[model samples]
Target chain A: MIDWSIIAEALPAFAEGLKTTMMLLAISCGAGLVLSVPLAVARVSPHRAVWGPVWLFTYVMRGTPLLVQLFMVYHGLAQFEAVRESFAWPALRSPWFCAWLVFTLNTTAYTTEIFAGALRATPSGELEAARSLGMSEATIYRRILLPSALRRALPQYGNEVVMMMHATAIASTVTLVEITRVARDVYYNHFAPLESFGVVAVIYFVLTFGMAGLFKLVERRALRHLRPTASGVA
Target chain B: MLHGYLPAILGGLQSTLAVAATSLAIACVFGILGAAAKLSASRAARTVAGVYTTIIRGVPDLVLMLLIFYGGQIAINRLADAAGWGYVDINPFIAGTATLGFIFGAFLTETFRGAILAIPRGQMEAGQAFGLSRGQVMRRITLPQMVRHAIPGFTNSWLVMLKASALVSIIGLDDMVHRASLASAATRQPFTFYAAVALIYLALTTISILGLRWVEARYSLGVRKVEFK
Candidate 1:
């Protein structure tokens, strides 16, 4: 029932699509990670001024659909005369830049919440010990809080990564030739759903499980301390 | 400002809600069956449910929708050709809801399974001692309590499903997103129209959260919390 020749012909396209997908995933995730740490720290701040705006930002972001966010950045911004005349308009015009900007912000909003939750869940005793040691606020945060919270956030953050990866498929709507876009093209050309979407489904399956397994390994190492001992005490 | 298309965009909310509500119902049906299968005595049922959840969860929703939409159309037409029937056009509404329901069903299966498992096994045995039938035990003893445990996960799935309904526009369903695009194209105010739609979505999300919280509280009325000092 399946046609091998069509998939064979589409292999080259899928490879290029895979490259685009990986690039989008790597850039957005790396940028999101860097941006989310400080945002998360600010998110947990005692001062309303520090945390309030961050709360609003994450709430708005998490509330709306990512596709709408993408449209606002991409098709929405171009409608402005000022944005068109601005120097940054050139960067804004590229689909790559728009995708990167949206995906990073989207993932950052989610990661910030995850990391902030993890930071909130940090053991009080750990903080007390750090403070009693005369550690500076910055030092305590840098050395103790961030490390433990990040280790705790690893699994959730891993889910965000996989989610963002899957989300890159939406980049196709804006004309980015990611895996989903490639699959769509293949489908339009051959009218073979089994050969086109079926193949892409397998590719995404591998990507999803690959990400899950990678996170499992990371959690094993990072959470080794929490693992049960030989006597069954955690 | 929605540039005189406010009503048009707002009207699309009907379609959006319809899609979300229909898909949610379908998802619940699939979810219960999947949960039952997983908890069944037969190993084959468990394996089938396992594969269903695994494959469905692993794929992207958009890909699945497109697959079932276009792929299903072709498959049905082929069957029709064999039966000497005419062409069948699959409605985007039907296709979108089916795909969303199918995809989210996998997630809810896990949620439902976990919720059911959270109940004490002794309760079931106690019901047996009381001479309640297995189905009676399920209905009277297990399901009601499961609702409390299931609420948090159900709320999450609903929120995700609500947002996911926006994707139906991609398959040509005239959801709010699609209406925004049309308005944007007409008025040349893409930002304003999309922002309006975004705000509407945010409102829906906030309202859903509050509503679900009330539901959760209602369900948990019988449960007592133990606090650790």
Candidate 2:
């Protein structure tokens, strides 16, 4: 029932869509990783003054749906005459910018929480030892806490990256023509849902597994010290 | 304009809730079956359950929703034609709920399986040794404790599913998100409607958090709280 010729014809569009999808994923995830470190540090601050607004930001972002958040950025913001008149309007009007902004913000909130949880769970004895060794608070954070927390956060962070890749599909709704949009276009044009979506499914499956495998390699390298040695296993 | 559109969006909230509730029910059924298959001794059951969870977890929900809603409709029509049944139309509600249920069922299967595994095996063996039948041992010993262990993961899945219900709007389900879009178009105030919908979602998630906390507390009644530094 599947037509090979239709898929062959649609291959170029699919390739273009895949590029857009990867670009969106890379930009959003890159921004999210950069932004989340400081946000996560702020999240675990002892003083409410430092953490309260950060908490509220992550809470609000996490509480709502990503699609609605995307809408608020892509479609909602333009509703305001002031926003339209603002200097940011040019960038805001572009669907790619809005999708990137929304995704980066969303993933940052989630990754911040993940990193914050890891930070909080850092063994206090290590911090106490650092203190007794005359390590400054900043030194302790930079040397001991952030490194360990980040290492611990790798698995969840990897999952978040995969999720962000999947989430880029939503960009299609705002006319960004990502993988899902290409599949839909193919389906409409060729009247073959199976061939159209089936191809996209295989693409996504490969991407997802490829990402998982990459993260697994990272884990093995970064976490090699934590692994039990062959001699120690006995 | 916000006041005028409030009732219409609220009506859509009803549809959204209905879809969420129905999908949760279906997901529970699929979860139980999946968990059973995973935990069973049968090789085929285990392999099938493993594959179901892996594929569902790997793909985006939107892709799966579109695939099932569109492809399932076409597949059904083909089957009907072959059977001389004329034509078949698939309801978006069924397609949406089934897809969400099927998708989240994989998550729930892991949750339930982990919960079951968390139960001490000795308890089940002791129950059996006390002359309790296998069914009685499961019902009396395994199930009750599994509820306590499962609550947290179940809550997580439920919250995720609640947000995911919004995706159904893309499949022409007339959910709150869809309504908000329509209202945005009509009122020419996308921010107002979308913000309203976001607030509604926040309210739902907040209430669910509170409710699940209560359930967790009720189930943890006899357990000691661990104080960790």
Q: Best candidate, lDDT-wise?
A: 1
Q: In model 1, which regions exceed 4 Å deviation?
A: B226-229
lDDT of the structure predicted as candidate 2 = 0.93
Taking the tens digit of each residue's C-alpha lDDT, what string does model 1 give over B1-229? 4557878997899899999999999999999999999999999999999999999878888888889999999999999989989898989999999999999998899999999999999999999999999999999999999998998999889888999899999999999999999998898989998889899999999999999899889989968988758
* TM-scores of chain A in all candidate models: 0.98, 0.97
**Candidate 2, B185-214: lDDT as tens digits:** 998989989999999999999999999999
lDDT of 2 by residue, A6-89 (tens): 999999999999999999999999999999999999999999999999999998898899999999888898888998999988
Is model 2 an incorrect, acceptable, medium or high docking prediction? high
Judged by DockQ, which candidate is best? Answer: 2
**Ten contiguous residues with the weakest lDDT in model 1 chain B:** B1-10
DockQ of 1: 0.85
* TM-score of candidate 2 on Cα atoms, chains taken together: 0.98
**DockQ-based class of model 1:** high
